[model samples]
Structures are given as structure tokens and as C-alpha cells.
Target: MPTDPRLTRLDENRVRVNNPHGIGATLFANKEVPVESGAVTELIEMLALQNTARQFAKAAPGSFDHDPEILRVAVTPDFHKARGIPVGTVLATRGYMVPQAIGNDINCGMRLHTTTLRPDDVTARIDDLETAFRHIFFEGGRDIPMTRGQRHAMFTGGLEKMLSETRRVGEGLWPLVRELGVADQLDRVERRGSLPAGRVFGLSDFMGEEGRLSRDGQIGSIGGGNHFVEIQRVEKVLDGTVAHAWGLKSGTVTVMVHTGSVGIGHLCGGHYRDVVRKLHPQQLKHPDNGIFILPEGDRHRAHAESFWDALHNAANFAYANRMFLAVMAAAGMRQVFGDHVGYDLVYDAPHNFMWKEQIDGEEAILHRKGATPARGFDAMAGTPFAYHGEPVLVPGSMGASSFVMVGQGNNESMASASHGAGRMLSRGESMRGFDDEFRKFMEQFRVVTPTDLRRADVRQRPDILNKKLEQIKQEAPFAYKGIGPVVNTLTEAGIARPVVELVPLMTIKG
Candidate 1:
């Protein structure tokens, strides 16, 4: 096994020690960067295939990737390099922020709903159910109508706005939010479904759009790339008590929705990328640069506030998107079996984006990309699902099994775990290699995409389906690492424990 020279094995779960300028360390309460410092370019030599587990621990404290705002950094077992940083990297920042840390997918997260229905509910009527799902997301079956004020409120106000929208437009939300009891369902949602967003400027212009007067133009849409809505069956309950309390029973059905802030997240990330880049004009000269930071200071106060506003707006929009998508999926199911059982919210949490939390007595800002905060049971005492710990959705690639685990609150993990089986192959690489693998997946699982029965014209043209499949080649199941091993690592690392294992029955994507 290859070992990382930069890190000291604090234990099996922890990778510590680093240079202030090289590979990073965990944030300390005192205002100081922990570990030794080193050179940045020396950190990268390039890899041929999947990244080794020690990639995050390879650099010293002051390595090329170091920043003053970054007090400490840790990588989960799913650690893999991203554009500027790496996925599964957890950074503890004191009075500083990095946009790359959160990436463009503002509030990219997962929402899992436990349904009163079971696998048998749709098994016999699989074709009808698939048709129904296709209609709601792609065909004319999408009936969600958002009023102007409700749209402004949602984008500017986050979940609070959604609450008001529910009152105005939530009457027909029966099979989705109504059956679950909206009040109770909303409580289990992260931060009750909203986070405070910085003020969204020119909100009025975006509101009165002809397509809208509500919901920043893309409310009921599912943007592409690693995003999906899948129907899964809980095949096994790993922790009986936790699964029971969370309404997850063996044979019970679920809808797992994963996506982000859509165009909003990209817009905010793009604006700040240039801003951060310009902040460190000197650093831009470095070959391995692009990473930048924003600290709490008078000089850059406005930039910080505006960035948060944009980031939060995108994040809230994402929360709304996932909620709305669930409604669409439920509507499709209802179309097939009139008056079927409804699904209740289990837990909703974001994997991407930056947030502040008090960890180990220090007010630390965590930039968690491709990581979920696994708050242990104690941190969730007052919450409804507190007994089971925070609900986490770890999705496998298309047509594969996804696992639902609960946070174990490993403070050393910075309260985070893998979002999914980290991508082993890049999109371009997968497009080149996944032909045979994709065929095998098609034979085994009920894979549904927009090119299916949703569009009559596309259905007629055999060529379109083939074209669409090629377009989505990047997300082929073989393109990612094994989901089983990733979950095993989390449990062994003491970051999270599995509650229920979910096997996908049907999947729909862009």
C-alpha cells in the first residue's frame, strides 16, 4: 500500500499533521494553522486511474493548496480530486470562505421520502408507473403553478417562502406533502427547509417573467449531470430500531431525489470564481493556483455579503427543486394507481455548499463538497428522527443499490461522510469506455430517462434514444467506485452506520 508522507495516522479514522503552506490540518481553537508547511506544485504528479485514498493527506501545511482562511482539512474514504480541490474534502475555516470548496452546485443535496406503499405497490404495474413518472417530469403532466409573490419569497426567503407557497399552492399536494402532514415533514427537513439567504437584488425582474412571475424560471425542472430521481425498495434493515423510527421498513418504497440549485448555483459560482481569482492576483501566477479565500474583513465586506446572498438563493432554490420534483414523481405514481398511499419526508440534507457550525467550541465554517454532515444522535436530540441520528442518502450510480445511513457524529470527520460512490472515471473517460457496461445495466434494471415514453416524437425515432444514451455515458454505473466499499469504509471509520439498504427499482434523469 502506498503511504502519504505528509500525514500522520492519528488513528484509522483521522489523517492529521501538515505544513501551514502544504497539506492542511484540522482547525484548532486558537487562531493558528496546525502542522508543518511545504511547496504546492510538488503535491501533484497526476494519476492514471482511480485516486488513492491518501490524496488529501499528501500535501504539507503550506503546500500550494494552502490558504490563511483554511484552518484545517480532512478527507473521507471517498476522497478524490476535483477541479480546484477534491471531492470528500472537509475544510474547517475560521473567518474565511472559499467558493471552490462548495463548487457550483449550491445546495446540491439529497431528499429521501418513505412511502406508505411497498415494492408490490408498483411492481405489477411497472410500465404504467414508469409512464406516469415520465409525464410529470417531461410531458404535460406537470401541473405545479407558482404565483408571483410565492416565487419571489422562495428565491429570496428559502423554505419560509415555500411554507407560504404551500398555503397558497399546496392544496393539491396530497400524495406528496399533504399525506405526510406538511408541518411534521417540514420539521424533519434541514433547517426546516430554508437557510437565511443574502438579499437577492433585481428579484423583481426575475419574478415577472412570462413563464413565471414566480420561481426563478426553472422551478419544476431537473438539470443534468449526476442528478436523478429514483424509486427504491428497502431490502434490508441494518438497524431495526433506527429504521422503524425513521419509517423505513423492509419492503417499503422510497423516492430519492438528488440535484442542486440548477442554473442559480452555476451563476453564483461563476461570479465568485472570478472575484476570488482576482483577490489573489499574485497567486494566479502559480501553475497550480485558482484556489482563493474570502475572510471577514471591512475591505471585502460587501463582496462577502453578496456572495452569500447568491449562494443561499441558489441553495434555497435547490431545496425547493427537490421538494417540487418529489411532488411531480408522486403525481406520476398517482396517475397510474389512483388514490395510492402517500410518502413522508424522512430527512433532507445538502452535500455541497458551505455552512457554519460550532465544532469543538470553535465557531468553524465548513466547506463540505461531496460530503454530508453526519450529526450523531446527541446533536439531534430535539429532532423527530433524533433517535436514529441524521438521515443520509448515499446513492449508487444508475441501476445500482443506494444505502441510507445515519450520522454517527464523528467530530474527527468534521461531521461528514461520502455523498455517493465517488466518481472513478471522468465523464470523457466514461464516454470512451462504458459501452459494454451500459448495456449490462440496461439488461438488469428498469432505467427511465426523458428520452423514453415522455416524448412521443423521441419514442418514434430509435436514433434519439441511442443519442441520449451516449450523452449520459459519463454516469454509467461502472464510472464510479464500488458503493459497497464506500459505505463499509464509513462504518469502519466510525463516521456513519447504515440503517437500511435500498435497491433501485426504477430511475429517471435528465
Candidate 2:
């Protein structure tokens, strides 16, 4: 049988893979399109640059081509012209998987928790809200000044110990929290919502020197990028029943916490990639490009174990990261509402992750790079949200509106959905192109900035793409494929369904 006549090409740095199967794959560059490499110039010349996937396949053709039943490949819009694989390409396979394919930042993601406040409430207390958030969420990252005895209890007793004396804002919040799935999450969450036990051995010692350990506790906290803890209102409820189920109503305000396992996760991911590189060279089926190899002995198993362990650690770090943010946010709300302000965890999940899930009842390692789990079944079988499909939160660019969506249990694309309005341009481009517009957009939000930092912050802060003004030109609200269209695509494709829509009142970027 003539192997599906494989043909490849490069357009600038973008590599295009063409096969009779109609599987046309393109891999992009993280940097801008290159100019004049000096000699050959043609459409085919550009195609010469294989994105990461092609490079991987080229490395170990025997390993990939030998398997017929399982491998599936996908390229997200983030794919750019590049020498290696683009950042967002996704690969799912049964029996074996690659850690680099999923990237080093496992479970690197965004969360958008909502509140019960209305738009009016946001404007009325905007000043107070901003003050509370600045002090509690951003600057309050250090230990909460626990007394010596309290410290002992936290170390010895764990979550229960800390919660017992936590300056919880009010009495009634716990029940509502239970309703939102926080307490239940504590049990069902990986490691019962705790940090991984030991130092990430796989990570390079250099990262250790860079302080990966110090940042572990900060994982549950928000970082820059459009990542934030925003207060939003249900500007529009596309589906009433779903919205109600999500605790979203037009007048109700909510909080959206967007973060992930921070430095620790990146360190873990990088370490695993190194493990793959080391093990690949020893595999029985060597890759064409020498970048990949198919291990025949315990090396394969070792590779798998290393990646899996790193993934678990990173995932737990992310979960703890979000939980801690919730603790801080809950504390601040108690300060103002005194009793009225409240929230229930709609859903806490990560977009960038990998898991061992069954595809057509066959075990497979599914990778969601810049994607979220949009399982169709009500409540993913092993999750707390099993009764309700896991809530999927898709945040828009900074000033743009965000989404509150739910997963449909189908295993399409390995039960995953888009992570966000996927970035069309790199952060570098946004900063260079949309400075003035950003200033205007942020002006509407009332975030007080220091004089020195204001200019520096505006010097092309790509993070502000969520703001309307900066978003206007490049990532303008119009630049991104509309959230409505994406949601519609998900529903049409049976990947996910929209539950509610959230518009930001104020946003904070790292």
C-alpha cells in the first residue's frame, strides 16, 4: 500500500503538511514572519520549515507511522510559521505521548469567577472594590502574617488547620461556598487540593536557583498576561436555564479568577521536556530528524512516568493556586458586603493540561494545549461537577467580555474546547501597535497608576489587550473571532455549550 503520499512545504516559517486524507497541517513561528534568508525564495521554500509536530514525526517516523489506529493531530490558530512545532498544535495518541507536544507549562490557564454584584454595584463601589482588591489580591501574596502558634497549626494540620482560624469574612459564606462546590472540590481535587509533596526533581537545578520553590505557594495566585481576578456582571444570558444553573442572572455580579500553577509548573514542564529529549535518543525506533525515538524497553516507561509525575505536580500546583485565590477573594468580599456579597465556585479548571482519558473506551493520553475540557456528559465521571458538566470559563482579551461555558461530555477532540479567544498576534506585536488605544480603554476603568510605571506599563503592555482601546486596533473587540461565533461553533460541533456571558467591570493585570 502506497503510504498516503506525504508531501510537505514551508511558507515563510509556516510549515504546511498535505496528505490525501485532507489533513492539511500548518505549524507557525512564535516570532514574526522572517524576511530574506538570502537564497531560495518560493512558496515551497517557506514550506521547508516544519512546525514542531512535523519535526517530531520526522525524528521518529517508525514510531508514529507504525501506529495506524490512534494518532490524531490538530493545529490551533496560534500556529505560526516556524522551524519547529508551533506553540499551540495538539497531538493525541493512544499508548504513547510526548511532553513537549503539550509544552512545559502544564495546566497553564485562566479562570473567571463571577460575583453577585450588578453593573450599578460595580460603579457605586468601584473605588472601594479597587482598594480592597489591590491590598488583598495583588500585594497580599506573602504569608498572611500567621502568629507562631497559627503557623505551627497550618504546617501540622493542613487545610483544616488553616481554615479553622482563617479570618473568614462572615458566617453564612460557607454554605453558599459549599453550594458553589468549593468544599466538595477540596475532597475531589487531586491530592485533596494540596501542593505536591516534594521538590520537582525533574526541573533543572538552574530553575531551582531561579526560585521555583519560593513560587510554589504563589501558584494559586494570578499572574500577568490577561490573567486576572475580575468582578463581572451577566451582561447577557444567552440561555436562561443554563445561566440560572450557573448562578448567573442579569443583575447578579460575580468574580472571575484567572491564574494557574505559576513558576513551579513551568519548571516542571521544562524538566519533563528534557527527560523526553534524553530518552528519545535511546529509543529503538529512531526518528528521521533525530529529535524523536521510540523507546523499546523501560526507557519508554520511564519517559511516561516522568512526564506523568510532572503533569500531576503541575496540575496540583494550579488547583492549589486557584484555591488560595478564592480564599483571598472571599476574605475581601466579606470586608465590604459585610454579609451581602457572595460567590459560589461555578467551576475551577485549566485549559493547558494533559490527562489519561478514554477515547472510544480505549485508553489515550489527551493533550489540551490552549484548550479546556468540554466533556458533554453531565459531570465528568470522576469530577465533582459530574452532576453538571464541568463549568468552562473562557476569558476574553483584557477589556473584552469573558464567557462562562460548560463542557459537553463527548470525547470529540479528546473532550476539549478552546482556551480563549486564541491570540491572533503575539504580545510583542500588540504592544508595538496599540499603545494609545490602550490608554483610552483603561481610562474607562479607573485603575490608578503611579506616574513612572504608567509610561513603562503603557510601553506596549500586551497584557492590556483585554482593555477596549488597545483592543480596538489590533486585538480590538473586532480582531478576535467573536466569542458568540466560537461558542456557536462549539455547540454546532457538539464540543461545548454556552451557559452565560460575562462583561468585566474592572480588571487587574500583573
Candidate 3:
């Protein structure tokens, strides 16, 4: 593929895109321009269009003490176009917060768990495990009941609060919580798997009554569009020392979860987007790109506070949501392999969210839409990862290999890394062909969903079966760029280094 003239190769893995309209962006990839050049062009166009929003903020008299500027912009290897902002794009700004940058699914992140169970153990009882996972994750087997106070605590304090409400979880995966010893694994998670929320907006309806165990539909669900729970085996250990420290033994089983705040995040995100739209100056037209900026000043102090609170509230719920999904996965394993199958959390970090950090001696809001933090030794000082770096979970497409990496703290890339193998084809494009490829993939890999293809009832209903097949095609390995090139780019770029490679055993998608 011919490279776009706008993209200038900086190094083997980094490209500088010259945006004529506004601030240019740095693209971290194996090539000067990705094979999917159209996506890169669209991303550049989106970046340039942000200038409209920036200009509006600059022109507002007394709304800001200084002009708001986009401090930095970085694109990850997995960069792809989304509804408004592209996935795998990171933007940093001072004096303003872009709610659209983080998108609807707040704190959509990855969580990895190391287990003592061997690959043989899982393969031996693979069918049984699939049945168990389907029942727990999709069917009515998941019975996590939470009280009103516990719900309040979760939205307010995240995983920390859930640990305190252990006794209240009288049934359903409660045993696995104690067996897994989650409290001891708190430190392994980012920010202790919690973000403080000043208030829980639009969550009162899901709270239920005090002292009563109520099961809500949203908490334990794996949301649609790329979110999944996968069981994998350590295929190779690239960095033996880091691998050993993180408990990743070759051939041992591990569970990788990719999900986020479900309905709650959508509620908060939609609310805030509407709030920003309403807050926009009536005389000025909204940006054609639909990106809105919420400025920081006494004038918008109340809205700013509410924005953070809502963002944190959704983020906290996501942390708890991923935790529960992990536990549910463990519960499935325990049911098939017995209580001897122990598990430990390796790391949990959000790929989509905003962070407050001191940049160039000034406070700035850094938004990572589909990028994960790759803070290095100095940034991770005083933590267990300080000796090495933060754990970066990079999962490939459904059937392909995933990688575990550690941050190098490259500030030029805004200390971030790709969340996954970027999509080379859109969902519609993916579903168009590759019939033989799809069939072969399904035969080789195990994917458990709410509808069992083997069941007579499901097979009889072609509509339901075809819908599921289409969904599967959309996420097939053929749809995404090669994981090899993506991870190699990260290593070559000094962004992050691979620790271990994981091969999928079984996948559960919702």
C-alpha cells in the first residue's frame, strides 16, 4: 500500500502526521502509515477538526483565563475510526476536558489473572467448562446479589468497597471470592481498582433496598462490541524475569477479561454529552465533528465537578464489573477443575478514561480513548511495578495470540500503548466474506455464548443462528491487523516491552 504523503516516518515504529489545520499527531506503528490508510486519514481529519472546539473555547470572553490548547496527541498501533473519536487515540489538554474523547464506555479496560491450573486440566474438561461458563455468564446461573448500601459503596469506592461487603454476598460466587483471596490482590490492580466518586448519578434505580441482596442485570455483564472473557495459556515467555515475577508459567492457564461499565457508563456518558451541548454558547454552532469541550473555571465549576464525579462513578462500576466477571470465570473453572484450581490477579488497568497529571509543570487532563497507561520505573515509583514497569495487557483478535508487556515510560507517546490489534476491516466488511475461514476458526477454537449452536432449538432457528454467526465474523482474526507487527512496533518504538505471549483456549463473548 502506498503511504499517505501527510505521514512522515520518524523512526522504524513512529510516524509524524502533519495536520495542516491544527495540532499534528504522532502515530506509533510498524510502518509510516498503516495498511488501512483510510483509517489513518480519518483520524488525522478528526484531530484537525478539534481546532473548531478549541477555537470556540479560546473566543469565549471571561470563560477562560488563557487559551485552551491540545497539549499532545498520540496514536497507538491499533488505531481505528469510531463514531466520533478514533479508538487508540490519546489526547491531552489544559483548561478543558473533552467528554467525547473518553467516549460512552467509561473505563473500558483489560484484566488478566494467572492460575495454577494447567492447560491439560482445561482442555480435558473443556466441554464441561463451556457449559458452566454459559450458565454462569449468560444463562441464569449468575446470582450476585447486592444490597443498597453495598451498591452505594461500589459506585463510591469501587473494588475497595466491594471487599468490605463480602459478608453481604451470602451466595453465588461468594465462595470463589474467599478462595481467590481478592482482598490480598488489591495492590495488583491499578489505583487499587477504585476511583472515588463524589456522587452516583443515575444509579439509584439499580441500588435496590438496604440489607437485601438484589441482582441487577448490568453489573456482571460483558458488554457488546469487542468485550469478552477469554481463557488462554502462556505460549511463550519473552522476559523470563518479569514473567516469573508476574506468575506466568508456560502452559499454565490464565483468564483475560475485556469489558467496561455497561448501562451505567452509557447513562453517565450520554448525560454529560448532553450537558456539554447545553453548556455550549447558543450563538455559536456546535462542531460538525460533535466533539464538545467543558472548560475549567469558576464559571463551569459545578459542571466540571459533576463531570469528574460522573466519570469516576462509571469508572468505579467498571472496576467492580471486571472483578465480578473474573470471579465468575474462576467460578466456572472451579466447578470443572475443583477448588484446587487457584488464581491470582496479575494486573487490571483501564484502556479508556482520563487522568490528571502534571505535564510540563502544568496540570492537564490526559484522555486515553483506547490506549493503556505505560508508565515506566520513575512514574511507577514506590509501587511493586517500579522495579520493572506497569503491566500492559494487549489482546489480539479472537483466535490470535495476546501479549503481556511492561511500560517503558516514553513521554513522547504520552506514556501509552495500544489496547489491542487494531481492526483492518470494519464489522460490515468483515461479515461480507471469509466463509471457509470462519468455519475453520470455529472448529479449531471454542466460543461459548448464550445460544448454543449444538442445541436442536438453536439450530432450528436460522435467524438467531445467523445473527450469532455474523457477530462472530465481525471479531474474527481475519478482521484485525497482525498482532506480530503491532507488538513489534511497541517494542521497537520504546513504548513497551513484551513479557509473555498467551494463546487462547476458550472464549466467552456477550
| lDDT scores of the candidates, listed in order | 0.70, 0.52, 0.87
* TM-score versus the correct structure, for each prediction: 0.85, 0.70, 0.97
lDDT for position 130 in model 1: 81
Residue 220 error, candidate 2, Å: 4.6
Give the worst 10-residue stretch by lDDT in candidate 1: 45-54
Instruction: Please give, for residues 1-510, the per-residue lDDT of candidate 2 as tens digits.
Output: 011133233433234445333433443221232212211122123223233234444455544422322355444323332223343445555545656545555666654455665688668876776667666665643233333333223333334443454444233233434345565445434334343323334434322232112232343356645466666778778778777765678867777776776776677766765665665533334433323322322425555555555666666556646666665666666666665666666666666776666666666666666767666545466665566676677777666777777777644345566666655555556657555666576576544211112356665665552453332334434334345445555555555677777777766544
Per-residue accuracy of model 1 over 1-510 as CA lDDT, tens digit each? 124465555654455544435535532111111121211111232110011112221321222222333455656655565675667767777655778778788888999988777788778889888877777787755665666666667777787666666663543443355554665567788887777765774345556654442333476677888899999999999999888888888999999999888877787788888786665434234224445665544556677788888888888888988888887877777777775667688888899978778856777778888888788888888888666688878988877789999998887778788888877776887888556778787776776777673468876887887788776677878877778777877887777899899998988887
lDDT of 3: 0.87
C-alpha RMSD for every candidate: 7.0, 8.5, 1.6
- The prediction achieving the highest lDDT against the true structure is 3
> Quick one: ranking by TM-score, best first?
3, 1, 2
Q: How many residue pairs clash per model?
A: 23, 51, 0
Put down candidate 3 lDDT per residue, 44-103, tens digits, no spaces: 666754576566665666555457777778999998888778888988887788898887
What does the lDDT read for residue 488 in candidate 3? 93
Report the lDDT of model 3 for residue 406. 97
